[model samples]
Target chain A: MSHLKHVAIAGATGAVGVEMLRCLEQRNFPVGQLTLLASARSAGKTVKFKGTDVTIKELKADSFEGVDIALFSAGGGISKEFIPHAVKAGAVVVDNSSAYRMDDSVPLVVPEINAEDVKKHKGIIANPNCTTAITLMALWPLHQAFGVKRLFASSYQAVSGTGAQAIEELERQTREWAKAERKWDDVRLPADQVKVYPHQIAFNALPHVDSFLDSGYTKEEMKMENEGRKIMHHPTLRASVTCVRVPVFRAHSVAVSAEFEKPVTVEAAYEVLRTAKGLDLVDDPTLKKYPLALDVAGKDNCAVGRLRLDCALDNGLAFWVAGDQLLKGAALNAVQIAECLV
Target chain B: MSHLKHVAIAGATGAVGVEMLRCLEQRNFPVGQLTLLASARSAGKTVKFKGTDVTIKELKADSFEGVDIALFSAGGGISKEFIPHAVKAGAVVVDNSSAYRMDDSVPLVVPEINAEDVKKHKGIIANPNCTTAITLMALWPLHQAFGVKRLFASSYQAVSGTGAQAIEELERQTREWAKAERKWDDVRLPADQVKVYPHQIAFNALPHVDSFLDSGYTKEEMKMENEGRKIMHHPTLRASVTCVRVPVFRAHSVAVSAEFEKPVTVEAAYEVLRTAKGLDLVDDPTLKKYPLALDVAGKDNCAVGRLRLDCALDNGLAFWVAGDQLLKGAALNAVQIAECLV
Candidate 1:
């Protein structure tokens, strides 16, 4: 292996894929060579990296021949089909898809919470869900202090989380509203703009995210509980989440009410969180300082605010958390795991 | 009181007040005389009701002399100042403010849940908070079937809930984005557009609503537990809520996870809610037919969907509810109380 790693990004033209490339550059990841991989349609395209253009290559089983590390941001089907081949070719995988996340052989890792788990990866490490990763960035510190048992969370997720197509869909619908000079009360999307999401997402709140399960929870909603337990190494962690797609372009914000096994005061939780890495304490309501999605759009650190004792529960704390899903939730998290590998 | 009572609307130029006038006209309340009241700035403006123009008069202490029923949509401060004058003038008041909702002498009512509480009013009947009203519309019948113990809720509130000025702010911000042809990734408001809200609400999610209380829950967030207990006659009920102001224009949506004393099945809750008054159950996920905020805007009935047994809480159920804050949350609820009185 080279002293500088050979890093490859799958689905190089996608939204998260684009961010993954930027994260590699901005974080100054050691990249002796960079391979941009996508399907035939996106192949022959060139994406600029480090002042040089890297030509995209069509991904096949032989694509990882000389690759030392593979970052997968394509959908679950693509990851499931291609990851084993990457592993067979002697490349370690950091998958952002859910295909192998729950598998015993794959270690689901959040670097701030469980960076050590990255070492436990057999051939693959899975990035936690966007909402789960952002929420746990704050919750992990609180859990370390108070031992969280369960939480109720609702997400204000971005159109970008659905990938590049959904972002364009929201933009198109919004442009349609603008072209027609529509009133705020008269918001509607022309049918063409509703292609990406199940419904129109511009200026609307969608209660559904991902596919629904027999349990009536979306695949996105249950990730907080299933992924939280795995990533936190707490087998009994429970979460009820309503994953909502809002009109925001990039950041995702979560409103969380967490119950702890031990008593928690706002000051003590603040003490634990102020020193926690990869998180910011933004909780001055008098000055109207709290986490807002727009403020955290390009930020690497997730912001936590609205810290209060939950008057509704025993040993409970309620707070708001927001982060750039493209950064902490996906690309940055995946790269941080590889940094651990190095 | 005469069979055809004199009706007066304070804050007649505001969003909820305009809706209140429409509710009276559409619901065909027996209005012998209609009195439209606003501040001195809006005085002499005429609002058409029942195909007749009613001139706006400045709201003063002596304005309610001949009024038999007064509906107030003004802020809490205004409500507190003028409610006594209205009551002392022999006008039964239905106030849509927080000024007296918690006052022991006033009856806080959601007509479907507690119409009988209307008869127990001592001169004034108070309306529940908009988000609370919309949530309880779905939770009330289920509470009848399952006996709710506590709830955790997150709200996607509309700008109109903050009154006319907020609606204009969102519209202005959106128009600014359109005027500048700003990209979705470059969302920011000029300092002027940030007048109504503490921050830019367009393409963003604000976690602050109403004012911050000492416990860190906004006044709007705590309204669910406080008002739900009064309306449902469940004094021991506890609620933890995160009230978020989204860029939505009209409807407010709530995602609630409620624990009940008796075990709940989706079918049982459906059976109760389908037959309940002023609610429509929209929960078939296969067709992608859960409730969306856009689907409920301008509608009188609140829609409940996304039903499933909660996996996070014992004997808990989770659901999503959407309703127009103007109709079911405020105006229609106030008019319904008047109907009960008649």
Candidate 2:
């Protein structure tokens, strides 16, 4: 444990970067030194680390020289450009971007599901999509219990997954509506109101999450099918997903109906989830207790509930899963990968 | 059209009641006269009708006198107590509550799916749940072409379905959050801090929409399976639903995977939905267009998109549907029943 390592976090001023700092503090990770790096726009900004202020430096190709670990969440373009440079600097990079997740050379790892996959990483490890990570958190436990064949899933994804700008957009539009209704007198818009999204997201749900692919599925929607196979080591696994952006600020929730090759029961699922790591069971429907975003917003483990047998398909189970998108989806997953390396 | 019937509306100040008024105006329903009724607390309130103010009368056993059509949406307790009275007063009742949906004598109608069921109504007709109605709007069309067998659905329900108060609750909480984060010091909390829900709704997604049942499903979740079978006239038709409450002010979206006896294809679904009344096709993924709550907020027709083959099930097709819960789910459906009678 005393063999601590220095960590450098790219996009240190961004939402996932903030979560990375919190995760390090929460997990008591062996952080010999911390380097906070951001873009030129965020350079010189100070961030608090364990009650001490750390000034952010502009990220460059040479910034990772002394850093043993590099966590990147500054979007795909930034990660694509800087990841190679960091890896060349001899740092093990855990990237929270889709740029390299599907790259054959990069291993996508969800530590709880496939930690051994980390050993195959070619300097850079990819974090699975928030929806994929949250869904697999519940599905993996069941997949181990019953051989999963296919899945039909719909995600109620939080706006935070889109980044900090989208979160501000939701809050800003919601306040605008409230003020317009004469429900309150105070009305103020955020100074930077560049529509990060196509539509106003304050009090609405958008079906188009990310850019649409040639297969007619949004980038976010195809992630479960594409990333799930890689993380679960199931090359032939099938999934159809509808990823939706909801007004939620934090946690992402997924409703899944999984079909397995073998028989599965609600009782068996409950038993499996109870002892599973990175999972919590809040599925007592009779008591009005189930996995909700509000309860799972700040938590590390994904909350799964509403588990029942699917009446429509044989050997199918229907369940609802929720987890903090910023945590399991991005920051915590990257940190967990770093932990595995240590 | 000269024989336009006299109409009465109970729960005239509620969320659905407001939509009922708008739907009647938009569709130009033939009405000899309009009677607005509400509980004692709101009896004297005035609501707009045909650009004129109509006073709300106290709803009682004799309040439906001389009325030929009555639309009830004042919760199940009020509907149960007043529906018989309205029936005895020579009025045909269309209820938007769960009070009589499963009753043997009551006919549940989704005008597009089973308008013929309206003729079977013995004085009272039941409206399907908002989520159930929005789901079937697109499904029934596909079901006709494919001979539907079963469905797995998850609803992204709006706060308005909970009533006017819940909408107010979402607005209030949002404002509270904005004021607390006084980036703009001008924001202040509204004087009336009334709570319509048990929890803060803004920036959060509540998995529990309605009251939980003994069978581990919310009352809202079971509505699809119970009311759907009744409305579809398929006593054995199966549905598994997970109803979620989102922060949208209007329009409920549902992701559905339906399995039919016959083969299903995206092309065939496109054809079925294109010609289907009460459904608008919004499924072009290339343009990043799909059914969204913001787009369907004030629309009568349910917007259907994300059409594809369900990879998990045999003969299964997956799609996403969004519709204004206030309109098709409540107001428009009720008004359509009146149109059928005319």
| Among all candidates shown, the one with the greatest TM-score | 1
Q: What is the interface RMSD of each candidate, in Å?
A: 0.8, 4.3
Least well predicted 10-residue stretch by lDDT in candidate 2 chain B: B182-191
In TM-score terms, candidate 2 sits at 0.93
TM-score of each: 0.98, 0.93
- Candidate 2 lDDT over B194-298, as tens digits, reads 366544566666777788765556788888888888888777778878888887777899988788999877888898899999999998877667888867877
Instruction: State model 1's lDDT.
Output: 0.93
Span of 10 residues, lowest total lDDT, candidate 2 chain A: A182-191
Model 1 over residues B88-175: C-alpha lDDT tens digits? 9999999999999999989999888888889888899998899999999999999999999999999999998999999989888887
Model 2 misplacement above 4 A: A182-194, B182-195
Interface RMSD of 1: 0.8
| CAPRI quality band, candidate 1 | high
- Write one digit per residue (lDDT tens) for candidate 2, span A31-114: 998999999999998988888899999999889987899999999999989998998988999999999999999999999999
Give all candidate RMSDs, comma-separated.
1.2, 3.2
- TM-score of chain A, predicted model 2, versus the true chain A, to 2 decimals: 0.95
